[model samples]
Target: MSTVVAQTEEPEFDLVEAALALCGGDAHATITALLDELRFVRGQLALSEAGMSVGFTRGWKPRFEIEGDT
Candidate 1:
């Protein structure tokens, strides 16, 4: 008899979490920041086809260093 195996998937960077991390783990800050960033990215997507695509679903990381870092 053969046994079935399950596979595990790696976690992708969450933008909301990253924003919260940037804002010192503040939920309000994360929501506000992510909303603004999302708007800007949506605008870019609408403006041009070559602008590339972005989504909150997954596959992203912090582009800048968090605050209070040396």
Candidate 2:
């Protein structure tokens, strides 16, 4: 039996490398920065959801609602 191997092409720009370069190659710093940005985005989403009118949203609700969240 013969098996065929698949090869993947590398991207022109590496996002992981770019992120490391921006954080001076500190892995911890890169992770912390990403987490902070995620928190900020989630907060913004929550605010937007809170402001949305039930009528405007047509009674639509988030599929997953976290406990203790308004």
Clashing pairs in 1: none
Deviating ranges (above 4 Å) for candidate 2: 1-11, 54-70
| Tens digit per residue, CA lDDT, model 2, 19-59 | 99999999999999998987887888788788898898999
Clashing residue pairs, backbone N/CA/C < 3 A, model 2:
none
lDDT of 2: 0.85
Among the numbered candidates, top TM-score falls to 2
Q: Model 1 compared with the native: what TM-score?
A: 0.44
Alpha-carbon local distance difference test for all models = 0.69, 0.85
Using Cα atoms with residue i matched to residue i, what is each candidate's TM-score against the true structure?
Answer: 0.44, 0.60
**Predicted structure with the largest lDDT when compared to the true one:** 2
RMSD of each: 14.0, 7.3
